[model samples]
Target: MPPVSQAPNPTPLYPWGVPPSPPEKSRVGLMAGIIGGVFLLIVALLATLVLVGKKIDSSYPPAESTLTAPGTLLDGHYKLAKDDSPTLGPSLEKSWRLSWDAKAVHGVVVAYHPSGGDRGELIVTGMYGRFRNTGEVRSRVLAGNGSRHTEVKVIVAPMDVTPSGSRIRVSCEEVTRSWADGKALSYPVCAWADGNTWARVAYMTVYTARSLDLESAARITLQIRSEMVKPIK
Candidate 1:
């Protein structure tokens, strides 16, 4: 009656010196935790993007940015001076003031510095013309603005850079004109017109050595003519 020889402690065998495998429960928990962490991280990233997008969207002008005073603002081309590139420079605060008279519509947008001052103006004017062509409208604009301001240097001629399928023509010139900021700003007055109306888009870009592609102006006016004016019978 000797003590029964105890069987050797039967632990799972490993091929080499590999550690024992983790329990199934532990492994499952680890996988779950990893998956949960990844899900949460993705959600956080999406939420952050949404928040940022909302903030950016909220930057829009509180009130519909008015164009200089009161008349028919030809409906067609969207915002010329956006909060984006090219049209919008390095300024912060800006708005387009709209106003018009009997036969015309005007738009004036200005970007201002944070410190308090003016940046420049992106202006558009739409004038109602029953059966006038681009040349007539262009001539009228030139004569009116010229008579009003004497400071100018002929840089660009009233070229026929009109848009395709549009009777609008593009005309640009270099001049120093008075702005709302009470300063004489220099820029090229680019304008375009069709059979129905004429529009101008101006920026404080002085040109002495070169010219600008007034196609944008023409395109804008073209849209206006297409949308606002009815086709002739």
Candidate 2:
């Protein structure tokens, strides 16, 4: 006869069954971390490559002691006003100095006041250096100027023969124009590389209203180089 049977503990129905399992962790944060790490690694690798390239470029042989800018060129028509100046200024930023990386560099700013004193003050800036590859240096030097202020025409033509009728290792010319006092002025930039020496020349004159001749500027550069770069005996 026994007491009434105790009701069995009621079990939870489907909706209230055992406690739900813990939620799975999200992988978004992990994935993002991995991607960031990879990107940083790639950037570091690129930086290392650039450093190696710069080191190789600077590993060229020592420059000859005699390689320098002369005091005078073109029969004293151009006189050296400054030698090895601390900086080349904005004009150089548009030309060789931007891309010029060499073992040794010599810079000179020449002043030209014609006998008649009618042409105003003409300046020639020359940059000489020692490098490994003539073509590479020449190309870099020319590319530095790019298309800035070059509205007339973009000329990067090869100069097979110089004024002396002798073949040059590598030569090129770039022409650009600018306005001064409501007058258009021209700048003829030239680059020449030979042996282990590289040179860049630029013509600037605010007094003259006429455009400068490219061929003549290139010839003058050659003359300047000839006088400056002497045999390393």
Best model number under TM-score: 2
Query: Whose lDDT is greatest here?
Result: 2
Q: Give lDDT tens digits, candidate 2, residues 1-233.
A: 88898999876677666787898767998899999999999999999999998887767655553445566666777666555344653354344444545544555555655444445444544444566666776776566555443444445554433555656643556554545555644556677776456655655554332554666666767776777678666
Off by over 4 Å in 1: 1-118, 151-154, 178-184, 205-212, 215-233
**Which ten contiguous residues of candidate 2 have the minimum total lDDT?**
89-98
Scored against the true structure, residue 202 in model 1 reaches a CA lDDT of: 55
TM-score of each: 0.37, 0.52
Per-residue lDDT of 1-233 in model 1, one digit per residue for the tens?
89999999877677467897776677788899999999999999999999997775454322311223122323411233432322432221121122121122233233211112334444554443232334765765655556545554445555565667654466665556555667665555666554444555555433311344456545644554444444334
What is the C-alpha local distance difference test score of candidate 1? 0.47
In model 2, how large is the Cα lDDT of residue 202?
59
Residue 64 displacement (Å), model 1: 27
What ranges in model 2 sit over 4 Å off? 1-62, 65-67, 82-84, 89-101, 106-111, 115-129, 146-167, 205-213, 231-233
